[model samples]
Target: MRTSLSVHDLSFTWPDGSTVVTGLDLAIGPGRHGLVGLNGSGKSTLLKLVAGQLTPTTGTVTTAGTLAYLPQDPGSDPRRTIAEVLAIADTLAALSRMEAGDVRESDYDVIGDDWDIAERTAAELGRLGLGHLELDRTVATLSGGELVLLSLAALLLRRPAVLLLDEPTNNLDGEARARLIEAVAGWRGTLLVVSHDRALLNAMDDIAELRGGEVRWYGGGFDAYEAQVAAEQEAAERAVRAAETDVKAQKRDLVESQAKLASHARQGRARAARGDLPRILVGGRKRAAQVTAGRVTGVHQERLAGAASRLDEAEAAVRDDREIRVDLPDTAVPPRREVLLLEGVRPAFGDLELDLDVRGPERIGLTGRNGAGKTSLLRTITGELAPAGGRIEMKVPWRYLPQAMDLLVPELTVAENIARIAPDASETERRSRLARFLFRGRDADQPASTLSGGERLRATLASLLLAEPAPQLLLLDEPTNNLDLPSIRHLVEALRSYEGAFIVVSHDERFLDDLELTRRIQV
Candidate 1:
């Protein structure tokens, strides 16, 4: 079998001297491969190293053919035109000059063999649902989802043999996500994607998990990899149990051996004291008994140590899947309470009139296309943006968790950020509340700028729910964008205990299903 991408003894270290990956080797053949791990497991770093965006500290990355990379955040100049983003502006300009009969020899050279490049670019954009966008339009008018798809389209136009995408579905809506997944499913050559989106991962031919600075390969897609991991965990748990039992038995044997040795020593002392034989004979027996006792105790101690070592190894194999446990009784709204009422409400963005009467703790899933005004509706409801035309009557306190998660002050610690919302709470109280979200001790003191994607989300959630008024109605926008699988699960666990009414805008079908939403409203 031939490999399209290969890494040999690859190692990378930050300038701060912290190593992200070391002695890592991977071989990816011509197939779609999904890369998954925890938030800080270096999946993106590995992808960048392989794509030649970053130089490795040691070792090398070898690619069989041309490579194209779609980064997680494909930042672009807002003033750049669509044609420039698609990388066909020069060729299109050459074609334009030729059509006007003003083409120079350099224009002919620039056009090269891509005579139909404009047509091909248009078709590719149409396939990615960007047909409505004109080539001359600046990217400033496009939504976040549209920008992501445009970046992907640019990569596809290159038609490289090895493609690397890092969280390409972060801001996409359901429709856009489907288009991206379809493209991934039909991809030829070698494609490696770093994503937490289960739907996107399910389209891969294989799964590569980057954990503990190493890459482990598994056959098939996300479901298959999950099943395999679950089985391995079960076996590891059984091993731990068996080793624990062995340790306990060894401890019991050691105690019994010590007791028997003490009894034998006492008997020898008694016989010697009573002059049962000559002093010499008694002394000799006493010395022999002492030696035997020492040997027996040594044997038992060695056995116990061995058992303990084995138990440690067995326990190390088990994974820690601790969930975030929290209860927000104060946020609960009464079943008969009328939480919000929107009558003929039109947002500032798209022309979608929303008329909603949210009662009780209704969990609504908001669905829409890329350019739809779902976020605008949420902002209007939260009074962050005035509605273009109708009335919004909010009977209870409400809070909005924006997709960008800019609620926290970057300079403040996690606890200090929470303090901004809960000013009356003491430092101890703040930390105690933050601990429920898994920010314990030193974690609670971490600066907002230093947090990982998952940690930042958790901290933001903590700040919202722990506010002074205790928000009864919550609006969440794309809450699971860049979170890893465990973090997504943690979010689910936290939401399970939240009693408030929330409208979450997400493209993740699996995540929405897990929420057991009362209703789904398409914007």
Candidate 2:
């Protein structure tokens, strides 16, 4: 019943004069709350402000008890040991020094009540599926999933009353993500998480949507919020229809009033010509009619204006984050052609060894545990790494989309990125293809550095898929790792129409299901 975290009239602006959040207010109670928004909608910025990592331009934040934060990136250094990363190495060393008879007052001060620190650390790590990970092990040796779990283990060990996690599952594989979800489900303290993972959001006690500089509350999980949005949109659309009808009615009334005024004028002219009344009386009568007609016309015009304004307001309430809608007839694959063959090949970089054959239009789902080399196998298939043994035979043109999405040149615009890949294609042709990915008009001219995470990925994918010679076989590595839900959905929808064979490595089960995979390969 009590509020644990509070944000009051918070506002933040970048150095470039871009305002990301403005006059935002939110109160989070003691529960697992999911914070969601579009990629560039300032969800992470709000968390950073709440965690005191960034000072808001105005207003204040207050927490009921001790607070801790787990950032999206986690700021992990590969060369540092787990203890060092957790920021407890110095305290542990002080305790060791005291036991070694240093007898320093500072050592005693630092190690005062934390005598059980080591035991607590081990217990927390084990609880989070990190018991096998040693405190002295460097982060460099850990896989992406392990690194994420280790970071979370550090947060759990602190036992803070309030915990803030931003995109905690950014690059985690399914196993690591499940471990986090389990940990979240057991949280007893106030927890606010900003994540794009629907599965993670589904585990929350409530969902908060931050949009247009405001936070809107919804009870329960992602499904509940979606239902609420659907209802709200339905009402908004209905208001639009009513407003449109009112405008039409007002226009018709004005037209009828004008016709009557014109007929009255004609009758007055005939009376004046026939000298049916005194000149003075006729002039006064004409002036009165003109005045009345003007008043009537102005009244109708005002009503029409009000109706048009209402229609605009109604339309504004409707959300227009349109999905990518484009036809890719050329990307479709036939059902009976040989796509690729791999014979007893060991990757030079990863620990995976494989023997496989892929046929036309086959959508292969590649999966494995972290460190099992899902990415390395894809790299090897793309000739980025040599096979230690055996051979890879590609029966058709191939293209590889890596996990990092580094295909685009940072200085190039979306249109330019596509143009670089398809040098012979005309500018018009290149733009048409990019438009299919939702990059239209000036959006296609935005530099790669300026795009949001989702936009950049879409641009990079557009570039690869629209190459000079259309690729028949596509190799994708961890494609769903960092993509937001909408971007993931866009990709899934696009791939549905793709005729080319694709081998994709993704830990998102939801994404895998949406792809309607033709075959599955476990590395």
Clashing residue pairs in all predictions, respectively, total 0, 4
Stretches > 4 Å off in candidate 1: 8-19, 49-65
What's model 2's TM-score? 0.88
TM-score of each: 0.92, 0.88
lDDT of all predictions: 0.88, 0.83
Error of 1 at 419 (Å): 3.6
Model 2 root-mean-square deviation: 3.1
Q: State in Å the error of residue 492, model 1.
A: 1.4
Which lDDT value does model 2 have at 460? 74
lDDT of 1 at 429: 84
RMSD of 1: 2.4
**Per-residue alpha-carbon lDDT of candidate 1 for residues 112-155, written as tens digits (9 for 90 to 100):** 78898988888888888899999999998788899999999998
Per-residue alpha-carbon lDDT of model 2 for 1-523, expressed as tens digits?
9999998899998654567788888888899999887666777778888888888999899999899998766657779999987767878999888788877888877776778889988887776678888789998877666777788887787788999998788667777788889889999999999877888999999999887888898999988888998999999999999999999999999999999999999999999999999999999999999999999999999998999999999999988765665465666667788889999889765678899889878999998887787777888888888878889998888889886788889888889888889999999988887888888898788778656566777887787789868888889877765466777787888887777899998887888999999888877
